[model samples]
Target: MQTRSKTSSLLSAKAAAAASPATTPRPPLKPKPFLQLNKHATTPLPIQEMNWRMERLTPPPPAAAVAKVALARNSPDAPKVEASPLERRRPAAATVRSKQELPKNPPVNWEYVYDEIKLFRRMNSAPVDTLGCGILASPTLPPKVFRFQTFTALLLSSQTKDPANAAAIERLKTQLPGGLTIESVLEVDVKTLQSLLRGVSFHMKKAVYLKGAAQILVDQFDSDVPKEANEILKLPGIGPKMAHLAMQFCWGINDSGIGVDTHFHRIANKLGWVHTKEYDHEATRKELQQWLPVKYWAEINPLFVGFGQVHCTADHPLCHKCPVSDMCPKKDFKPRK
Candidate 1:
């Protein structure tokens, strides 16, 4: 009985131990090795590695230093760099010149001319707008009448003075059956026309031309003055100067071509705007157009014509009293006492 009781107690103890939770076993702690405090032997790193480290640490050089380096590279003492053939062949930037530096014609003092024109406009009151050229003067007349009258006046004014041309135009206007209309001019006999135009220059020849011009207008252009400058040139006795003037006065066409007369040519030459040896009107016209701006086309003819009449005459120009005397170069001038 004692042995059985001890065996039962041992079994109960095993069951209790098996039912309780099991804990993991702890790891063994490692022991640290001993160290000695000794002085380290000083030694340099590889040259490349040391250089790389120094470069990484150093700051960049300044802009002035970089520019000096570039300039030194291009200096004569520096080694020459051979350029490629193509690079050597390439053109450099072209040097452009101003018009003033390379002038085509004798350079005009345009500022002085403009100032002189303004002064002439103020000082001289010679009825340039109203009575200088009778053709340009009578714009108030009827369109057809204006055209015919202007043409007739230009024809009569070839070598005639202003007052005499005015008188001739007046006589023809009153004496003609119906007036200076194309029909009236055509109706008047050549003999009667010559009588009426007796005061003007080239009266006899102009009388015949008047009839021919009237006939041409009647046959072609429906008795109306042509708008085209070329068409006006087709009519007998209508030259470039007359045609351009007529177009400006009658149809208000300007700036296409300038009217170059003796007075205009003289004034332009005298002002040194044109440099032509020959006294050719057409050549002077082209030269003036090349140099002078387009705006001066219309005003130049009338202004110079009026000025030529009063101050800058063909025979004896009044240079002392002239407005542009100080500025003008005064080519081929002969002063009058």
Candidate 2:
């Protein structure tokens, strides 16, 4: 009877607690400690201790200490030292080369050279007959016939003395009634023409070339010279220099090409305007045209030829009296007085 009474009292107490509105709250959880990725040891350090150690991490050695370490290392014991932050970073000055280290052929002040040519030309007499110059000096012929004459003069002039070339041209004139013309040259027997051109350099080959070139002109362009550069280049014994000379002197075309003869080539190389060991005129002509302005073309050949003949001769140039000696590089050249 007593046990049944106790059970009934316990049930009544549980019911009273279940009916109550207020209850106890749960405790807050603690945050997990962070582990560093760089930590390598098996036993992990506590968060506070690890953070404290990170704050006091070792910094890079001072410059003096680095120097001492580098000095200590020698021979096979020399360690490959890593570059410092400053050293590893690119230097600001590296982007541009120093003025002293720049290419040897500095930009040419062409105007200065142009001024020199102008001054020299004004003071000097007319240049000696280079075949092209001689042809240009002739009394103007009819346009229809002048091209052939100018071209032939250029062909006959190569390696021939100026007097010899002039004499040969005079002989050719005697062969033809009017003047040296396409029909006149072609009509003359090759052997007769060769004999007339006796004093000229390579007369035999040149005579044959002259006849063949005139024949081509008559057949291709009706005895007229073609104004186009490509067409002019197609003729026998005609190169860029000769064709261009004809264009300028005969056809009144200017600055279309540069005529580099032996004198011009030698003088240009000496001036440091061109750098080449080649003794060929054709090669020098191509190289010089790269830097030489078209406006200067009219003056260059004349100035060089005149200077070469009078002052800057092949074997012994008169450097002491040369007008532009102060400005000339005089490369590979030693002047006599």
Q: Model 1, poorest ten-residue lDDT window?
A: 90-99
Candidate 2, residue 297: how far the Cα is off, in Å:
1.8
TM-scores, all models, native as reference:
0.65, 0.63
Number of the top lDDT candidate: 1
Question: What lDDT tens digits, residue by residue, belong to model 2 across residues 1-337?
Answer: 9999999999999999989965876677876544422121124456786566555333334546544544545346778676565323211122111321332433243344445554444344433533334353356677777667767777787776667777888788776666689989988899989999999989999999999999898999889887876788888887777777777766777667887777888887676566666577777777777766677675577777766765677887877756455446573376555
Clashing pairs in 2: none
Per-residue C-alpha lDDT of model 1 across residues 1-337, encoded as one tens digit per residue = 9999999999999999899876765878875432211121123446785576455434334435544544555688976655434223221111111212333453534554555565454345443444555344366777888888888887777667777888888887788887778898888888988889887878998899889999999999888888888998888877788787777777788876788777778777676666655568888888778867777777778877767766678887777656566446673376565
Q: Provide the lowest-lDDT 10-residue window in model 2.
A: 91-100
List the candidate 1 regions with Cα displacement exceeding 4 Å.
1-106, 127-129, 134-138, 277-279, 335-337
- Runs with alpha carbons beyond 4 Å of true place in candidate 2: 1-110, 126-140, 335-337
* Candidate 1 CA-lDDT value: 0.68
Deviation (Å) of 261 in candidate 1? 1.6
